[model samples]
Target chain A: MSAQSEFDREIALDAADGEPGTYRGQLGEGWRIGGGINGGLLLALAGHALRRELGETSADGIPGHSDPMAISAYYLTPGVPGAVTVRTDTVRRGRAVSTGQASLVQEDETGREVERVRVLATYGDLAAVDGDATTTATPPQLPDPEACVSAAQAPPQFLKHATLLERLDLRLDPATTGWAVGKPSGNGVIRGWFRMADGREPDPLLLLLAVDALPPVAFELGLPGWTPTLELTAHVRCRPAPGWLRVNLTSRTLSGGYLEEDAEVWDSEGRLVALSRQLARATSPRR
Target chain B: MSAQSEFDREIALDAADGEPGTYRGQLGEGWRIGGGINGGLLLALAGHALRRELGETSADGIPGHSDPMAISAYYLTPGVPGAVTVRTDTVRRGRAVSTGQASLVQEDETGREVERVRVLATYGDLAAVDGDATTTATPPQLPDPEACVSAAQAPPQFLKHATLLERLDLRLDPATTGWAVGKPSGNGVIRGWFRMADGREPDPLLLLLAVDALPPVAFELGLPGWTPTLELTAHVRCRPAPGWLRVNLTSRTLSGGYLEEDAEVWDSEGRLVALSRQLARATSPRR
Candidate 1:
């Protein structure tokens, strides 16, 4: 089998029980980021768990919805590779919108279960709603995807250990990737085309990971380092078409060691799929 | 007492319990918008409750933080005037940051409890951490406060019943308030100076409401009406100095009857007090 299938199989979860709403999954070695798993992957895992729980028969007399309209996740502890469990609670099941909360936990060395992530999501049927206005906002103008430099072509020696990079194909816009050449733009913006490494179709859950998968926008502001998210909230406006996603991220200010990152994702068909905002630590890079 | 003083008294919450973390408050007559209490005031009420809970001695061994780092609120239902209770749960108490969740619930007609609002907040000491960088973002440029038209001098007939307006004083930037005169610039931006109507000092809690106090940005797009928030997330960066706050709100896309509003609040000293983004319904106004 190919590496893409292997990565997908490792991330796929299995339902353990339907009554109390539980799922069992594991973070394979491919999802590792440094000593722990990626935060966006964990969020997607919880979102997938919630999707399964809500996909069931009507809970609280409200039918299950398919698209996630809003999702907020809080990271309490770094996730480890091992047996993991996800428990979901259906907060309210309304006709137009439904809300749910999920907790991702794993066993510690003492055999005690510890919570690693907590997320709340709201899902609704986007097609059912009538359109009030058409979008005048166009996708970010960029060079042809085929003409751009793919992150998969030549892995930098510094990022050799970043196994997560192997799961996604990122075509960085040559104009915005100046940081790769050590010439920071100082214009807090990053734009690029992104898609699954395995040529898999993009979905709402995949969009979640794609939003944060890019290098921190702070890198362009002369700050080179990992900026961990304190909290991230995303709003899904429409379902994505089957193709590459155009993403643009920017920050207006970086003050007091904290900065807010705003991101927008547009599908290949020129449709806005999701918008997200995250408050993260802007740690000074140690060179 | 002036109407401003009366409005403040109505929204002020009282600590109902010294332990277990509970607050009792009421939404009075002046706080109404249409038929329900204003959502911004509700957020402020919850923020106040969280501030009070965190201000007490360390709970669960976590040190008491001084300012709100991030807050997210989901409006489950329209709030009604009566006795409302806010119960807080300390999720985790760390040395630098603490996490907590609060549920704003009220008793229904049958005496059964119903949750009207849910919020999660993170609190930390802004002064404890050393500054790594400075912001290049300047506060929204507007005319002096004394030269602008105050929302208090005259109440428009459409907003005559909106008593919540009496509690907060708004000096509209002449360039952005053209919607009041049946003309719009179609720029999708609003800038103004805001403070409590009763001359009350703007605290972290007040900053929460101030972020959403202005008219929805959708009005500029020729869609005039009530645009309610589905979800709003805010990050408080610094302890706001006592003075007027300069605010600017903008929207990038309005599609499929939904739009996201982004706002920034800067204190008179040019310090960014808060940054917020909200997903709200873009409903058309009835002609």
Candidate 2:
């Protein structure tokens, strides 16, 4: 596939480090491999690995894909100074889906094992994963992200910090009153429109990433800006290669400390492209 | 606090990526931009992010201290080619614990906007998440991983595939086969003892990653290898820092094309370190 070259050009270039390579990238700056590279950077690197594997590569002449819904990692050995190596392989592949695994390591200067990792990835047909495809109806009618007000729009004075809600383009279903994270998105939601500007206007990809970002609930209770989605699995039909994909996401908080959220991403005209579901450990500060 | 310097010295001054002045770490030769990195690496990165924000450095922090019970990720735009950036911050760092958030992205040629990612993370007095952290009382007696029939001994047909289980050093409590995966675990062990290698060898971090490696079973069909995880979550507690970790996983195959598994992890000494729960969309070609 044409994408293979793109994948190789992007990830392979930096594909060295265990002890030698330095953690690269901006988000990686926040991480302090010893002092700064953070967890978010590690995840981005992992995602980079995935894209490289799938970008131009396909299994059995078919592109192997996985809409990751959840992920868990253990920072075993910190990325040490020196040569680093990423070891990857297809754990298992199937007719509809495939799983790939990778490990990031900082070479051991003294011949000792440094860090290790194991991944469980799954790929499949879109129908089973996308609620939008299964939704026998249309998405709920709602205001545009531009016309909506921030639900958590109280003063920072009343709280302690700023949240993504403050940085997001939000719209709520009038029917939600605010409990709208997981209510039925009405009829066919042909599009999901989410835009997060990281300086200049956000691009379509950024918008999609933000739209497909962790559920709003994930950021609800923690400090100012904290929403970490360990893994993501999105299911789509005739997956869109849209110029601008708009996603309408909603979530439901369960009684136990669990929360379930689903999002329907669409093209501008109201054509549902995919469905995404996520589970998060919901926490609220004890008053 | 001293750990910070330890962490800093570990990854600082590494080689500048070919991009010049940037650090590079290999994930795999084939993975990169727009291609998603491996899930395990992403999680590790996220863990590193959380630790950085929590002011915990070194493996001693974040992934170093977690007993992961659950995790979820949302894949945004495919990772971009070349250096991705990641940003992480603490969500709620409370007395016994707190939560953190991480964001991963790839820079554009302009290095302006981030390409993708936002993660939600939680950290607490691990016990808090598992409300059931009381000690389990019994005459300590578990089926030695060595004594158990190796998945290798199963059959030639099942040989190649069980590579994962073969390396597992599963320790099942004799009174209840709680920590086993795939099969043979008996008793009302809502959970059981599981590990990749069966012995005194210690590899806690790798085991933490292993916890997420299990297939998300849709139904309790005793098929060969076809469990698709829809979602998974883990609540952590306390346990061995740099040693073997035990997984006590058990699942109930729901009739409606779904299955739910509950798992708990422990240290070699039997201290409860984490609790896990998961749901899966089970399907297969055989049964």
* Candidate 1 local lDDT, A55-129, one digit each (tens): 665935667787778888877777887888998888777777777888889999999998887787887777754
After superposition of all CA atoms, the RMSD between model 1 and the true structure is 3.2
Model 2, span B179-283: residue lDDT tens:
224453323232234543433332322433445533222212343344444434444444344455555555532323444455555666655554445545445
Candidate 1 per-residue lDDT over residues B11-118, each given as its tens digit: 577777565788898877777664467887888788777877775558355568657788888877878888899988776677767777778898989998988778
**A149-250 per-residue lDDT for model 2 (tens digits):** 443543443223323333444444343323233332322122224533222232211222433443343333222222233333343333344343455655
Q: How close is chain A of candidate 1 to the true chain A, as a TM-score?
A: 0.90
Q: Please, what is the TM-score per model?
A: 0.92, 0.39
Report the lDDT of model 1 for residue A258.
85
Q: What does the TM-score come to for chain B in model 2?
A: 0.56
Individual DockQ of the candidates? 0.52, 0.04
Over 4 Å off in model 2, which ranges? A1-24, A28-45, A56-90, A93-96, A102-120, A123-138, A150-192, A196-208, A211-215, A218-238, A241-287, B1-68, B71-287
Tell how far residue A65 is off in model 1, in angstroms. 1.3
Deviating ranges (above 4 Å) for candidate 1: A1-11, A57-61, A128-133, A152-158, A284-287, B1-19, B56-61, B128-133, B152-157, B284-287
